[model samples]
Target: MQALPKTRTDGRLPLYARLRDQLASRIANGEWSPGDMIPSENRLAEEYGVALATMRMALKQLVDEGLLERRRGTGTFVKQPAFRADLFRFFHVHDVEDPDGPVIPESRILSRQEVDLPPEVKRAFGDDAGGRCLKLERVRLWAGDPLLFEEIYLRLPDFDGLMSLDPKEMGPLLYPVFLQKFGILISSATDELSFGTATQASAKYLELPANSPVAVIERIARNPVGRIIEYRRVHGRPERFRYRVNLGEQHT
Candidate 1:
């Protein structure tokens, strides 16, 4: 194997930290790709002229961050974020006959307009929030019936040209659009689920009775830098919402 380049030490971070950051950057920049096993600890330690313990610490840091994975018999590999897990955990579409089967809901863009930023929406963006933002009202349909009504907000200028795209062209998911169109990748997201009375718009879009109890989900998506890029509030029929969790050993 070729000699691994010594990690650059700019005098700010410790050697192990520098090594960790270098490895993470390589993965983020696609030097090593998803599912590809990385160099073994002994080989990496020998190449970097670092102690095995130091190299192990660096690799462990990346593993803890979910950027790398270590198998008992297999080698360490790059870890791709599991978007499907989150979708199945939160999305409200499921087949009745085949409970484990996948369902791809149809997307409908009810309206797209530039709207005044609400206080809550502004806070979602943190300092990046401004006076104006784009509001998109949409619905997801399963078998021609609405499953979820969503109100999406995006910071202006970042998503300025998004309003012009046809709804059919947007596909069933929005994260891909952020990547393909705006050069933005959703690195992490937080979803808060609660029960609330359906709003008038939700009632109209979701075809629920007036003031029906609905499952509300507030999803905030951020880029790798932790800058909030999208804020969405989704309302779904409480009966249609199913949440499942697989619990393993808990680490306190």
Candidate 2:
């Protein structure tokens, strides 16, 4: 039997809510990884010293929030993000020969260092976040041409030892590294797409003339419990940008 922390010390919070917070913290801390089956509800109920129904309610909340998924004959496992599909949906990279086939661009990490957080980035990570964070500068290339210049920001401590890793080992996608190395599962992201003129730095890396119009994508990525983990701003050549969407039943 385990005791739930009374950090809130509020009598109004339900027992199941406290249990939910504890379980979420365990998941965040990597007690169970993505695709790994969690202990059964009966077992958890015993371990937590809570009623079966109470445990079920707590688990149900996580399931509803997409942190966990249930299998009928099997048990519950942590939900894995569909990164490939999600990436293609946002990046719009594809093979030249097979335009419909999604492809991952070759990535070159320019720099990695600890830096003071930008105002917007700090706000997204919330008030408790440290003033400093890990910042990365990278460029994506395809067909030997620079396609996108990226400025990526990650929360501190959560990604503490990442600076020691060789950039070449990280490859193109960062979400996989987040989960496999740090046990941080990126569940979802919200990207805002807009058209903007390139900055001097963006122009230098993107091989564009000064003030060239570019496709801008600002993304806020979150974990299963909705903690913002990464904030990225990408600028791509407008000519290479493509957006496809299908609406109505016909597309379905």
**Candidate 2 ranges beyond 4 A from true positions:** 4-19, 49-54, 85-92, 96-102, 249-252
Model 1: worst 10 consecutive residues (lDDT sum): 1-10
Say which candidate scores most in lDDT: 2
Instruction: Give TM-scores for every candidate, taking all chains together and pairing residue i with residue i.
Output: 0.71, 0.83
- Steric clash pairs (candidate 1): none
lDDT digits (tens) for residues 143-179 of candidate 2: 7789889999999898997999878668788888888
* Residue-wise C-alpha lDDT for candidate 1, range 176-209, written one tens digit per residue: 7766677665667889999999999999998989
